[model samples]
Target chain A: MGVQDAEPLDVERIREDFPILDREVGEGTDLVYLDNGATSQTPESVVETMSEYYRTYNANVHRGIHRLSQEASIAYEDAHDRVAEFIGASGGREEVAFTKNTTESMNVVAYAWGLSELGPGDEVVLTQMEHHAALVTWQQIAKKTGAEVKFIRVTDDGYLDLDHARELITDDTEMVSVVHVSNTLGTVNPVSELADLAHDHDALFFVDGAQAVPNRPVDVEAIDADFYAFSGHKMCGPTGVGVLYGKRHLLEEMDPYLFGGMMIKKVTFEESKWNDLPWKFEAGTPPIAEGIGLHAAVDYLESIGMDRIQRHEERIVEYAYDRLTDHDDVTVFGPPGDDRVGLVSFDLDGVHPHDVSQILDEHGVAVRAGDHCTQPLHDVLGVSATTRASFYLYNTREEVDALVEAVDAARELFAV
Target chain B: MVGSDMYRQQILDHYRNPRNHGELEDPTFSHVGENPMCGDEITMDVELAEDGETIERVAFRGEGCAISQAAASMLSERLPGKTLSELREMDRDDVLDMLGVDISPMRIKCAVLAEKVAQDGAEIYLGEKDLDRTSTE
Candidate 1:
């Protein structure tokens, strides 16, 4: 899919692929689902792929020489190839390691890399807008290794303070991990520039692509990231399956995250040798059926084209940002322009976010209301919580209008 | 207008025009309870003349969702001249029953916010703190 030749996203056609979109919530009210940032609705094809995998090839891979094992192994390895190509990883299929979710992927990096390399007098640079998964894992590694974790401050408008980021990345910095797109504020950080800066400092750059991979086109090779992590559920695939992409050289250098049966090449009473790049990271029996579903999800996204998905979400975000900003009582928090994903965080005057969400729910609109697991960013914004409404290809402009009307109704009813 | 059935008429009436939605001056006993998850802050005050263990005067001031604000207004109306023991004996079910409609389980906290504040105020009025006052236990 070339940039100029990308076909425009057909929302109605896409919505038809998701059966849950047709169901009504309360008293024949249409379900206006705007919570795609939390978890996307899987298409029928992806669901059917998982069902087909279980019904057909229900056997363990890499152990048995039987026909079922061979079929399962081929399916599992094919899924890895699809995912590797999806993310634009330079290495071949062996570089992609399956994990439980993005959180586990990040923990693998922190434990395998951070625990081994970082020690006393070492520093790790992070950002204020990171989800707790990235923040807590690094914090734990820093505490255990007697290293210090520093943060790059975020401005009130939710852009990264690049000057602070540059100042934080010094010679002592050993690793720099940041979110590609903020889950709370929806600000798209400049990962390529940050990656360059980390390379300049001789530090490894790990990009938390959990939020970015679902909404935009992610090319890890273009960004030159050392490690990239994303979850399948957030990308319209099933839960309990995620990908951890690493450069071949860095992956070979790092130790295995888990010591188990499948991760070992050969085990003796005294010594054990770990397997190659991906198998070393993936211990025990993996989520084989989930992997097949994720391959279907990747195919679904590719059929629609990620560039078109970005443009489609950009249009909706621009419209929603304008509508939200036009309201006198609304206080929007995030990037002022359309340089972000479809996630929008805002607060209405004198109304709590929970109250706003409840009122919207009464109107058959769904949204998320909380700190969004970005407490440090919330502290920087000086607000406790905000109501978030994220969009996807299945969302229509009419849903945006409905959200606006419901928000106005909530404000009028609360009189705040 | 929201449905009168979903939100009871009294609840909407109180939410639209609350009775006590401002701070009290030198309240005899006051405390602030906040839902950090949603940033809803409730500062309740209780002025008790206390005619033989009876709450002579009870009032509250806070900002929250409709359910919380309506519950506070109704509690203010019901607690004045009620006995301290009676207020302490109040349960979440009693608060929801007063709302005149059943609410989702998640919103039970909103319905009980005022009752908890009143109980805390009653405990302060009796000069007791850091003690469990819930009737369920």
Candidate 2:
């Protein structure tokens, strides 16, 4: 599949931005890092932006009146605005809340919103394909509040069963929380349609956009989501930073997930009045450098254009799908190659994914093996585990070829 | 890459053709262990001797990578005829030696899941045996 592209963005130029692309592993085999879904490699731009912040204006934001504090505060607050715009968030700056990671973002909503709104006999809806972050958060909230959880079934080819989803999201449903993209299955869900469905039933909708935000364009307004959550590390930003975009009304009604310094306006010995919209949620000292780095990451993605990156990944995924299917023993999961995101999760005929990955390691080909923190999704797919190879802007067709070659080598080593 | 190393031919052989691979009918003791990180699970069952001092039989059922399954199969073969005390003294290094492969720190979970399950079951079996004896007397 040497199909030519329309060339909105030069992928070769994009690959040049990632310094890790030229790395060597093991005994000098060229590195083929395919674990972007776990964490994408950072570019020089993100590195420089964060480093410049530390060297130039390193101070606590929104606290000090010094020139350094003013500049740092501007950069940090600007990051929240950039991130909001990145997702096409209509609620804008007042909607964004920075947290530790996507997991923390989900916890904030579950603890702050779900715990307060949901009650006994109220239903929380979730798809079987949800990552542990979103699924476990809702489960615990349901348990604490005596609420019930309903699951939407997955179709045979790994798409969400809308018929089942319709049945599950009934009038009793208080919230509909699902992953926008399946991290292990590579299925890009219809977030807008699901959001519409959730709204029709008078239920709040939350999209775990952890995997989707890195691969495709996500317009929160268009989707009509009440809340959307994603992480920075998965999108080539530094760790310890994530975003939770909730509607202003919801944020105002809910209690803060964390309570401490910086989240309060008036501090008394007995009682404390909380801060406004975003500040009410961001407790303690926030990750200033990480917030600035995330802004740089958003800028990097915008420079390439999300649609172009999507198209680029589509070609690479199609090629990888074709290459993987060439093997008689391989079984790729999720929908067909055309329907998935930039990743492919699959298993060999007899080889376990961990063994396959270990053999791939010997070839300097990196892949994620195991349950992928979505064990229930793997259980739905009737597999204990799988090996996943994911792509990003820096990945190439040649890198996919290396992945196939390494997989072939693994098959040979494990062949009976 | 697997040339006579950790992923040896013998390990693959044991993995493909596991011995005593199913459960015993209402065994005296049974325990399931899982490597939560990798989702590898092993359920070990043991039939205690009439005297309750020894394991009369052992069987395991599991699904995982070659190392974990192979280790389970190999451990099952050696479990029968071992005293409860002997089973309790089993160590991680002993299982590694039995597998005849050098496992990495990352995969220590894979190679040791079976032993972990078995030893845990053995401990419970020994404790229950004492409790039964005391209550009966």
Candidate 3:
């Protein structure tokens, strides 16, 4: 509650690594980007790595016998290894599959596992705070399979109601999927405990780690997650690439999500045998350049420890929370504690989030204002929308000050 | 001072004291609409005159940003005595012109939500469309 210690991150030097941080928006105003939760700006190392790949050996992976193809394939495969190691997936590349984004990763599992396994009267346990990616996917799958989808209630203070989860994950629960961190509330759910509960119920544990893998230290094996999914764009990596880590046995047992050129072992006119793990799921040409960029992104994140980055975000979020809550007209949502992720969702007393966001944009401070792809959670919070300012390793206290000032400007304009 | 350019004086005034802001007791046509992207919602209710052609009374109830609520208020103030055909003819430009401000492309849906609801209500009332609600996504 008092002035905390300074974060142990050289944010200024880190800022220099991101060139766009030096750019301006709206008539020479410096950009105070607080939309990291949506998509993080790629650092120079990642951009350069992708550029180098394209500038040199650019070819289709896993097919050609030529030198360039071999180089591309090796780099692409190494990208999978890099991701697996970063997330502490002991099965390594054999268990990690590349998808377009976290949404695609969830879909892969839903198609390969959910459609095949879920049946009438079965249940899929999910959290109310889940993004539409996991929520809608499982919902539609349940509808198709005649399976029921139940939600774990979110507490008033923005936490997973573990008691509700315990009640929901009973004998008939087929899958228990939840977000490791709530994108809207920044509430870090107790995923390991949830995973253990799912395991006890004989349900497959799936984690939507889109917000968590990039912010904090994640060990898929340690958490004993059956499947963990995260996006590249949220971790200072390039778009069009994401990683899904599944336990080796589960992934090997599941059917292929897609079928095409590279994922088959032997194709006849009537039948086809699928390739080994991972490639069996990734159909056609993979995101070669984006995958390499993500490898570089992982390298960059590792260079600056994830623990330090987490601490830095905590400091910045705490500062923003303190500054914004200082005003009588502002109301911050989520948990009133220090253990949240590096973001804050709040509402102005009379102003709408869209208007508040427009005002913030005018002041060159970018924040997300909407349901944040969690409409059900917003309903639970009793708000149609909320203004969210998400932080990252590069975000600074000065940027938080700018966000508060811009919010003040919005409140003043609507005060009359 | 910063966001005043977008939230003009007229827009702010209408937003603060919206005109005809409530549900009509007995209305000929009522339609609910929303901009799902930003979660802005508006419900429009209209009472037709004795002739059953002109708008005898109009009221709206909803929650949204300054641009959306103000535009709804401004549109409600201009709805009396207008025929269903005229209401259906009203478009995005008419709503923007009523607000007297440049709505950014992102917030244009917010600025035109009420118009969509009112126009859709008139269309449904005239049996031109078989839709219950409208959305400016």
Which candidate has the highest lDDT of all? Answer: 3
Taking chain A by itself, what TM-score does each prediction score?
0.98, 0.97, 0.98
Candidates 2 and 3 compared by DockQ, better number:
3
TM-score of each: 0.91, 0.91, 0.96
TM-score, second chain, candidate 1: 0.83
Question: Which stretches in model 2 have alpha-carbon errors above 4 Å?
Answer: A1-9, B1-4, B19-32, B43-61, B76-87, B128-137
The reply for model 3, stretches above 4 Å from the true place, is A1-7, B1-3, B48-52
If the candidates were sorted by their TM-score against the true structure, best first, what order would they fall in?
Answer: 3, 1, 2
Q: What is the DockQ of candidate 2?
A: 0.46
lDDT of 1 by residue, A291-388 (tens): 98999999999888898988888888889989988977898888974777888999898777877888888888899988898877888887888899
Clashing pairs in 1: none
Which candidate would rank higher by lDDT, 1 or 3?
3
What 10-residue stretch in candidate 1 chain B is worst by lDDT?
A: B128-137
- Output the worst ten-in-a-row residue range by lDDT, candidate 1 chain A: A1-10
Q: What would the per-residue lDDT of candidate 3 be over residues A1-416, giving only the tens digit for each residue?
A: 22133348998999999999999996789999999999999999999999999999999998899999999999999999999999999888999999999999999999999999999989999999999999999999999999999999998888888998999999999899999998999999999999899999899999999999887889999999999999999999999998889999999999999899889999999999999988998999989999999999999999998888877888788888889999888888888738788999999998999889999998999999999999988889999899999999999999999999899898888886
**Collision count of model 2:** 0
Give the alpha carbon lDDT tens digit for every residue of B1-137 in model 2.
44536778778888888998998997998888777666677888888889887778888897778898999999989888888778778888899999998897789888888887777667666564322111100
**Candidate 3 on B25-93: residue-level lDDT in tens?**
999989999888877789999999999999999999998888888988888889998998898888889
